[model samples]
Target: MFEELSQYLGWTNCFPEGESFLVIAEGTDCGFILQHFIHTFLKRKLPVCLVSTSQTFSHYSQAGIKIGANLDKAREEKSIHLVDLMSKFLNHYTGQIECDWNAKNIYLSIKEELDSMEISANSILIVDDISVLSSLCLSIDDIGNLLHYLHALSKQRGFNILMSIPSLDCEQVQDTQSIAEHYADTVLCVKSLQTGYSKEVHGQIEVVKGGRSNCGVRQYKLSDKNLHLFARGTSMAVL
Candidate 1:
């Protein structure tokens, strides 16, 4: 969907099948990037299972419409399956008056949902952001294990995995973060500018492909319509 980003990542038309993508947002929300992936897959007529721990299906639907992807239509056609963890969490705390922070339950829920859906090599499973799991009092090891299980499940089901997580400490790489990176075929690290905020540039993104020597870094700015990526040192105001 984004030509500059597609070219930077060496994707001609669509993302590679059955590959894992780890998006680590250092100091900002990377939901836009995740939405981009959803848009891409929907454009290709591929199925998507969105495991959202942070946002609702309605939120994605509205955002997808803004980006030219009709998530509601996709959902109606059974091309998009949503697992709303946020709603489940809310219900658990309010209705049931209980807390279940077990990562295994999360894993089982994902597996069950995927099993009930139509999956292929080109299908994708997207986890909006995993920071909520940490807030739910799940340990780092639990989160890591959940990701590992999801990765394995994706591999077995011949589908791609797109997972987003926040980095608590930018300088200190936690074991959970390392585990996510280790299992990913590609990693997109979104970090705020060390020089501080700018009106033209929102942040920087580094694309790392496993076993690849060449990685690309780009400064990006977000718009209501789309994301604009510029080469490092290039400012959007100059464009």
Candidate 2:
């Protein structure tokens, strides 16, 4: 499956080194895609740090599944760390209003935790719905700066960063995605299609970009506890 995607995107490696950004539309199986890629291709038994503002992690856990590594084993090994920013922020505050200082403090807390980890270059950091982070603490420009800083830090430490942005709120996250697409080594856009009058599910993907101009998008499916890629129609040249 990955072989087909690698060929379509002209990528030499399936899970390439450095930071990669992936954006998904709402209700798409973005989390599943990330989990499958890490479990199937990486071949590393390292922990996956999920930094999320939404209840995505909780939702996945409730579904009797996890993103990466065995949940029980990870818990035993103290590997998987689920940081719920919203909960943490609300817990730290007493008033109904939110403050920028409080938000910065949360960011610092996450940074400190990441700094303390003994993870290597193979470890993955999944920042689900960075749009929430942007809306909470910083302006659009500041969010871009923060993302650049995170990308640089990840590259320096040899860790991979996977971030998600919802397409429905694209205006709120367009700058973040644009910065990621330009700075990160790779960018993947996960999209879904509805076909026929009956709303039949047509296809989904992990469309790769930011290298070769004429590369084509590959079709990927996440079902039956597996992720596989196949040849699909080509997208516009990303030059």
Give the number of the best model, judged by lDDT.
1
Question: Per-residue alpha-carbon lDDT of model 2 for 21-120, expressed as tens digits?
Answer: 5655544646655555445333456656767677555564543253334554454565766666767556546676655643356557667768767767
Q: After superposition, how far is residue 101 of candidate 1 from its true place, in Å?
A: 3.4
Q: What C-alpha lDDT values do all the predictions have? A: 0.83, 0.59
Model 2 CA lDDT for position 95: 72
Cα lDDT tens digits for candidate 1, 32-125: 8888889888898988999988889999999888778889989999999988888888888787656576889999988888988889899999
| Residue pair clashes in candidate 2 | none
Q: After superposition, how far is residue 216 of candidate 1 from its true place, in Å?
A: 2.6
Candidate with the greatest TM-score versus the true structure? 1
Against the true structure, what is each candidate's TM-score? 0.90, 0.75
